[model samples]
Target: MNPGLLLPSALFSLLALLLPLLIHLARRQQQQPLDFAALRWLGSKPKPRSRFRLDDIPLLLVRLLLLALLALWLAKPVLHGAPDRRTYVAVMPGVAATTVAMQALPANARKHWLAVGFPSLDSDPPADAQPIASLLRQLDAELPSEAPLVVLATTQFDGADARLPILSRSVDWRIVAGAPPSTPMVTALAAPRLQIRSDSAHRTQAGYLHAASRAWQTPAEFTASSAAFPNNQQIVLVWFVSDPLPTTLLEWVAHGGTVILDSSHALPQSRHPVSLWQNAAGIDLLQAIAYGKGRLLRFTRPLQPAQMAELLNAEFPQHLHDALQAPGVAPIPADARTYRPQTGANAYPQAPYSLQPWLALVLALVFLSERWLATGRRGEQA
Candidate 1:
C-alpha cells in the first residue's frame, strides 16, 4: 500500500540472496593441505561428489525470484482508487415530536429527509414520546444509499441505539443534539409562577410582569417589561398551552425568527381550530423549529444557562448567530463560528487493516521454499 516501505523490503530480498553468496565465498577462503594417512580410506570408499553445485543456476534463479516476490508482497502494495467527494445537506428535527412525526410522514418523505440530514433524534425529550430505536427502523426504509447527514435536536439523548443514523453501505451521519438542562442555573433563573389572567390582551403584552413586580417593585417591573426585547439578541418565543399563539408569530418565523411552541399546548383542541401555521414541515413546531439558512432555532422548554451555552456551542450555531445579527430580529451577539466542520474533509470514519492473514501466507511461502531446497539436497546425497 505504501511505496515508502518498499525500499526496506527490497533490501531484505537482496540480503536473502547475499546470505548464500557469503557462505560460498567464506568456504572458498579456507585452504587445507592433503594428508597421505587418509589416502587408503579415501580410495576404499567411493569418492562422494560435492553436494552443492553452481550448475543449478535455474533453481537458484527460481528461489531468488520467489524470495523477491515474497518480500514485495510483504511491502504491502495497494492500488489507490478514485477519491470520493460529495456534498450533503442535513435537516435535523428536534426530539420526541420529530421522532413520532417522522413515522407519520410519507415513506418517500422520510427517505428524502434522512438522505440529507441526520437520522437519529435525541434519546429523550421534555415531553413524553416514542424511543429513537423504534423510529430508526421505521425510517431506515427511506435513507439514501450514500451521503452525509446532519442531526439537529432540542435535547441530547442517551440510549442503546445512540449512533447517528447512516447506512453501512453508503452514508455518514453526524449527530448534533441540543443542550441539556443545567440544575444550578435553572434554580437561579427560575421564573416565579404567575396567576393566569383571563384578560387575553394584557397577558399578551405583559404575561410575567405582575409576578416579577411582586418580587422586585414597580420600577423593576416596568424595566423588565420594557427590556423584554433585548438589544442585539435574536428574540425566541416559547408559547405554552394557556395562551394561543398569534398569527403574527408566523411572520416572525417566516422572516427567520426563532419561535418555539409546546405541542401539548399548541396542538388544536375541540374548542378551537388548530392553526395550520403551527405544523410547519409536519413536525408540530409546538414541538420545535430550527431554520437552517436563517440560523434560528425554537424550542418549548426553558433551558438553564449552561444548557443554553451548550446549545449555542454544539447545536445550530450558524442559524443562531444569523438570527441574532439581523436588526430586524434581536440585538444579542451570537458566536456563529462554533462547531464548524474541518476544511476539505468529510465526516466519515477511516477503515482499519487486519494483517494476520497476510502474515500467515508469508509463513506458508517460507515453509514451502525451505522444503523444496531440502528435497534438492537429499536427492544430491542419494
Candidate 2:
C-alpha cells in the first residue's frame, strides 16, 4: 500500500519550522569587551570579521522535525489500496445449518443467514418471510468487488422481484435438497359481511348499501340494524345516519373495522387522507383516512342518482368492495437454480483507509521528545 495525503494543501503549515531556527540564532552568546589600561591608549586596529553560528544544534533539529511532523498530521494521511476480499456464504432460513457445515467451504469464509438482519448461522433461523432477491442485491452491493459469494437456498424461494438481480460478480448458487417451507391450504377469500345503521330519514338510502352487500354474495351473513353500534363479527359497517359520528364509532374504525360514512358527513381531520375511489373522469368519488389499523371512508356526494352517478353504475358494487378491502399481496415462489444472479450491474468504489490515528500517535511521541530535549538537564547545561 502507498501512503497519500487527503488534504495536501495543509502542508503549507511546514513554514512553522523557521521558528526554531530564529530562536537558536537570536539566543547565541555575545562576547563582552573588557577595558585594558595599556590597550585602551592605543588606536583601534583593523576590525576582526564576525561569523554566524547557531546554538544547540541537537535541540534545534528536534524542534524542526516536530513541526514538520505536525504539518504531515494536518494533511490527513491515508493508505490507498483495494479492500481485502473473502468468500461469503449465506444460507437461507429453510436450509439447515448442519447441511451447510457439511459442505467443503473455504477456510476463511464467513457464514451468515440470508435474512433481514443477516444474522449469524449459529443463531435461530428466521421465521418471518424474507425478500430474497432484495436481500441478495443488498449483499452484493455491500461486499467488495473481488469477493466471492455462495448462496445456499431451498428449491422453493419467496419474495422475489419481477426480474432477477444483476450483480457486480457472478454468484455461486447452490440448491440443497431439503423439505420446502410448509404452505397453508389455499382457499378462496371469504366475502365481506356488511352491517348498516341508519335513521328513519335515511332508511331509503340504506337499501342501496344492502343491495351492494348482496352483490358480494354474502347476504346470508348481512344484517341491517338500527342499533347504536355494530359488533366485531361485522367487518364493514355503513353509517347512513345524517348526524355527526360519535366517539364510539371512531373507536371502532381505529380497531380495524372499515366504516363508510354518509356522503353529507365531513371526514375527520387527518395528516394524510388518501383517495381510494375515482371515476372515469379522474374525479375522486371517495376519500379515506387511516385510523390505526382500520380506514374511515366517505363518499364525496349524496347517494342520489343526480348527485352521484356512480351509485347507479353497474360496477358500483365491485368498486365499493375494493374500497372497503385492502389489496392482497401476490406470492413469489421460484426455483433457486433458475434464479442465479447475472453479472452486469454497476460496481461500487471502496473507501480508502484513514491513517490519522497512527499519525496522531507518532506526533505525540515527537512532541514528548521535543519537550525533553528543550527542558532537560543536558539541554540546560548545553
Candidate 3:
C-alpha cells in the first residue's frame, strides 16, 4: 500500500548522514614522524597516506542507524493500509439491548453491541428522552476513518424528533422496522406544601403564587408572621423583602426547599423561561424569573390592576401552573427517526491516518539507546 507523509519537508534531516563520516575523520589516529632528514627521504619514495579511514565500525553503524531513524521519524510515514474491522455496532435508543438482540441480531454479532441511544456500554437509555445527533459525530471523531460504522436501529417513535446523522464514511445499517417501546408518565408521589409572605399592595404576585400552588394540587397558605417556621419540609414564597434577604430563605434554598422571590427584590441571574403582559400601548411590562428551585417576578413600572388585567385570564393561570410544577416529571415521548437509508445512501470516503505516534515511539527507543551508549563510552574514557 502507498504511504502518506505528514511532514515531507523533514526529510532534509537525511543530510545528517555525513555527520558520522565527519566525526570519524576528526578523530583519525595520529601518525608518528621520524627525524626530519630521514623522514623526508622516506616520504620521497612513499605514496601519500589518506587522512581518514574506517575506525570503530560498530559505532559508525550505530550512528548511521540513529540518523536514519531521526529522518524517518521527522518524515512521519503512515501506511494507507487495509480497511479497519467494522465490528463495532451502535444500538439505537428507545429499543432495549435485550429486546433488540431478540428481534434483530444473530447470536454471533450481538456480542459486540454498543449503545447508540446513549452511547454508553453500561447505562440503559432513557425512555422519554430524545436521541441526540451529536453522539454519532463524537463517535466518528474517536474511531479511525478506515473503521466502518454499522448501525442497528428501529423507528424511534417514542423519542423527540431529531435529524438522522450523515457520516463522512459509508455506514452499514441493519434496520428493524418496528415502533419504539412504550413510555410511562412519571410524577411525584405527593404535592409539596407552600407558605407565602403576602402584601396587600403586591396582591398580583401573591395571587399568582396562591393560584399556581393550588393548580399543582399543592396547599398554599398566606402568613403575616416574618418569624414563622415552615412545617414538614414545606416551601415559602416571599413577595418583597425590604430588609436583608431572610437567612431562613437561603437555608430553605440550600436544603432543597424553594423560596420564590417577589418582583420587589432584585433576583439572581437564571436561565428560566418567562412570560410578560403589556398594555395596549406596548410599553414595558413585568418580567418573571425561575431561578434554581424558586421563581422571581417584577414589573417595569408601578403595579396597576388596570394595566395587568390579563393576570386574571384563564390561560394565564395555566402558565403559572406549568411553571410551578415539579422539575423532574417525565415528559411525553417524541419520534426521532428520520433517515432510513437505501443502498444508494451509503458512502466510502478517504480519511488521513497519522503516523506521528508510532514514529515518536520508535524515536524514543533510539534516543534512549544512544544516551545509554554515550554514557558507557564516557565511563570507559575516564
Candidate 4:
C-alpha cells in the first residue's frame, strides 16, 4: 500500500482503458468496401469477423477490468486496522535467580522462558548466558519488533556502572535479583538452599579445593586457554573431586553438552544447605553457575525423583518439555503422570506469512488462462 506505487497503477489502468477505445476507433476508420468476384463461393467460405466488433467490447472490458484490479492488488492494497497485529514478549529467565523464582511462579502465568546458553549452528542452540543486551538483540531479530520484552536476571542491580542498552528500548523489562521486592510487576523468591553432604572430612575438604581450582580458572584462565582446545570441544571443568574429567567430557560440553550438577555433597560444614558461598580466596561461589556455555546446577540437598523433576522443570523447562512432548529426543512421552506435571506454553513462536499465498494463487490463474487461450486457437486452426 505505497502511495507512489498506487499512482503508477492508476495511470496504467487509465492507459489500458484508452488502448481498446483507440483500437476500436482506428478499426472503424479503416473499414473499406470491396466487390466480390464469386458471390456464392464467398458466402460459402468462412468470413473473418471484425476483431473490434461491438459484441467483443464487453469481453474486452472484462479483461481490462481484471488487469486493473490485479495492478491495484499488486500495489499491495490492505485494509487498515485488520487486527492481524501480532505481539510477543521475550521472557528471559535470569541465570540463577530467575530459575528459582520461576519455580515459585503459578503454573498459569502464560509466559515463555528462553533458556540461556551458547549459540550453535548444527542443532537448536541453547540461549546465551550473557547480559540482557546481547539476548535482547538476538530476540529482536528472532521475534516481532512490536512484541514486549521482559528480562529477568539473577544478579541484582546495585546501580552499577555497566550500562545495558536493552534497558532503554520501548519494551517492558523487569530485573529480579536478591530478595523479591514489593513491586506488583516483579516478584522475588528465596534462593533455593543448597546442602552438600559429606560423610568423610576428606571429601568435604576436597570439594573446597575443587571450588578453588574453578575460581582460579576464571577471568584469565578461561580466556587464555581458548586456543588450546577445539571450538566445539573446549574443556570448561577445571577439576572433579573424584578424578580429572577426561578431555572428552570438555569436548562433549563444547559440542553442546549440558553439565548438570547434583552437588548435594558440595555444601560446607553447616547441616542446613547454603545457597551462597565465598571460597577461601573470597571468590563468590553460588549454588548454580554457567561457565563456557555449559550450565552447572549444584543441588545442596539430595533430590528425590520428584525433586529432580522440579529442578529440571525450573532449570531447563523447554528442553524437558521438548524431550517429553516430542518422542524423538528420547522415547519419552509427555504424559503428566510420568513426571511431576509442569505445564507451560512452548517458548518459541512460529513464523507468519501474510500476503504471499494470495499473490501466488493469482499468478497461477493468469498463466492458466493464457495457456487455455493458446490451446483453443490451435484447435480452431486444425
Candidate 5:
C-alpha cells in the first residue's frame, strides 16, 4: 500500500522551519569585558574557549517544534493500507435494489456490498457517472489484482460508449436490462453572436462549426476574413493557414476578444510559450494562452468535418463553448457539466489515516507552553 498526502506538494512549507532558527540566532547576547586591572592581569593568558552554550533552550525548542507541527499539519499526511482480500458483490448504475437483495457473501470473503468506491452501502450514495469504462479501469488499478470482482450493472451502461479503456483485472460482470442513468440538464445560454473565418481549403471544417452552432439553436455568420472587428462583443473562431498568425487574429485576441485556434491546421512558431492544460498520459490535449486581458485556446484534436462525421464525440461543442465563456458573460456553472467529478476531489479516495488533527493538537499544546513560559513570569510581577 502506498502512503499519500492530501496536499503532497504543500509539504514544501517545512522549509519555514528555518524561520524560528534564524530568530533564535538573531537574539544573540553580547557581554562586555570589564576593564578591571587585577582581573585583566589574571585572565591575560588566553581564556579557555567556551563551547557553544544556548540560552532559553526551552523557548527555542518550543518555537521550533510549533513550526514543525504546523508544517506537518498542512501537509495532510495519510497512510494507505493494503486492501482486504474480500469477495465483494458490487451493484453498479441502474441496478435494481430488489435484484441484489438476496445476494450473500461467501464465508471466506470479508463482505459483499456496492462498488461505489466505499466499503459499505450506508456511506454517501455513489454518483451515477458516465464513461463507466474509465471508472472500472480505476477500480481495477486500486484493488488487489487477485481479488475476484463480481459486478452487476445494466446492459445500457455496458454499451454507453465505445471507447472502453482496458482494465487491469478481469471482471465477472452480469448485465441486466434496465433504464440508463439520467443525464443532468445543462442550461447553456444561447451563445452570443459568433463570427466564423476559414481558408478556402478548410471550408468543410467551417461548415461543421456552423452546423454545431445551429444544433444548439444559435446561428453564426460566416465571413471571408476577420479583418473587421465587430462593434458588438462577438467572438471570432478561426482556422487560418499556419505560416504567419494573421494581423486581424492577433489584434482580436490582444483586445480582449477570445479566439479558439483549431489545431487541425498547423500553426506557425509562436514566440510566447503556452503551458498545456488537461494533459493525459503525457499528451497535452488542450492549451490556454492569456493574451493581454483576453485569452487564446488551442485544442490538440482535429475538429474537421470528415472527423466529425466518422467519429464525433460531445467534446467539440463543449470545448468551443468553454473557450468562448469569457469573464462577466453569463458564466456557465462548472458543476453543470455532466461528466465532471461529483466531489471535485481526487479521482481515487485518499488513505484512511490522517495526521492533520494530531499535528494540530501538538501545535496547540506547544503554543500554550511557549506562552506560559514567556508571559506567565511577566504577569506575576505585574
Candidate 6:
C-alpha cells in the first residue's frame, strides 16, 4: 500500500530538530590542564584542527530520532490502495434479522444495516426513511473494489430515486420477507368541486374552466363569483385574474388548496417551478409551483382555441384535471427478480485509513526509549 500525508505542510515542524542538536553541542566536556605533566608536553605541536562534534552521541541520536517521529506524527500520514476482500451483507432497515439469518450468507461475511455509517445489525434498525438506490451507490463506492456485497431489502421500500443507479459491482440484491416501509399515500376526493373566482376582464377565460368542470360527467359543484374567494380547502380554485393574488388568497393556497391561475396572472415567488403539462410538440402548456402543502398551476397561454390549439384538443380536459391533481405516494413493490445492479460503472477511490494512532503509539515508544537512555547516563554519572 502507498503511504501519503494528509497535512504535508506540517512537516515544517522538522525545523525544530536543530534545537536538540544545539543543546548537545553547547554542553562542552570540561577540560583541565595538568601544570606539572611532562614539562608542558615538552614542545607544543601545532594544535590539531578542532573537529565539530556533540557530546553524548547515543543520547543525541535518540533525541534527534524522537523529534523526527514527532514531526511525522504532525503530518498525519495515511495508507491507501490496501483493498479489503471480505464479503459484506447490508440489510435494509425494514427486514427482520431472523429472515436474514435464514439466508445462506458467505462464510465469515460481515453483517451491517444499510443505513448511514453501515451500523452493525445488532443495533436497533434505523427508523428514518432510507433512500434505497442512493444507499446502494454509496456502499458500492466505499467498499473495496474487490469486496463482495449482498443487499437484503423488503418487497416495498420508500424514498426511491427517479432512476435506477448504475453501480461499480454486480451487487447481490436479495429480497427478504418483512413489513413494507410506511409512507403516506395521497388520496383524491370522491367528487372534485371547482370554485372559480374571476374578474370582469377575464370572464371569458373562466368560461373555459367551467366547461371543463362539467365535462367530468359527474356531479361536480361548480361556482363562479366575481369577487369572493372560496373558503373551503376541498374546492379546487380556478382563479382568472391578471393582477397579483391578495395575501388572503395566497394563504388559502398554502393551506392545501390547489389553484389554477389565468395565463396573464402575475406569478407568485417560487424558487422552483415545474412544467406540469406539455403539448405534443413538447411546448409547455402549464407550469406549477409548490406552496406549502398545496400547488399553484398557471396556464402558459390564454385559454382560447385560436392562441392555444390544445383548448380544442380532446385531451385538454384530462390534461387540466391531471395538472390540478396533487401528487400521491405509490408504494410499488420493487422487482428484486429483475432489479439486479448493472456493472461497468465508474468506481470511486476508497477513503484512506488514518495512520495517526499507529504513529502515535510508535512515537510514545520512542519517547520512552529516549528518556530511559538520558536518565541512565545521569545515573552512571552519579
Q: Please estimate how well model 6 matches the true structure, expressed as its whole-model Cα lDDT.
A: 0.73
**How does each model score on TM-score?**
0.28, 0.49, 0.47, 0.35, 0.42, 0.49
What residue runs in model 6 are displaced by over 4 Å at the alpha carbon? Answer: 1-23, 26-59, 74-76, 80-82, 184-339, 357-382
RMSD of each: 19.7, 15.8, 14.4, 18.8, 15.4, 15.0
Model 6, 110-153: lDDT tens digits are 99988767889999998854556657877888888889999887
In the range 1-382, model 2's lDDT, one tens digit per residue, is 8889999999999999999877766655466778899897899888676545443666778889889988998999989876668899998778877799788899999899898789988898877446677688789878898888999988876545435678888888888965545322222225677777778877767777788888888752334444655556245677888777765565555444567787788764422457778998988888876543355678887777887788888899898778666442123356677778888989877667899898889889988987887687466567
Name the Cα RMSD for model 5: 15.4
What C-alpha lDDT does candidate 4 achieve relative to the native structure? 0.37
TM-score of candidate 4 to 2 decimals: 0.35
lDDT of 5: 0.54
Of the candidates numbered 2 and 5, which has the greater lDDT value? 2
| Residue 322, candidate 2: C-alpha displacement in angstroms | 12
Better of 4 and 5 by lDDT: 5
CA error at residue 194 for candidate 4, angstroms: 47
Instruction: Give the per-residue lDDT of model 5 (tens digit) for 264-381.
Output: 5433232232444342355555455444224455656665545333226556555455534533221111111122112222334324677677777888889999898768545754
| Candidate 3 per-residue C-alpha lDDT over 270-316 given as tens digits, one digit per residue, 9 for 90 to 100 | 22334444445875354444322223344454333564665666665
Over 265-291, each residue of candidate 1 has an lDDT whose tens digit, in order, gives 332211122222222244322122222
Which pairs of residues clash in candidate 5, taking residues 3 or more apart in a chain or in different chains?
Answer: none
The ten-residue window of minimal lDDT in model 2 covers: 180-189
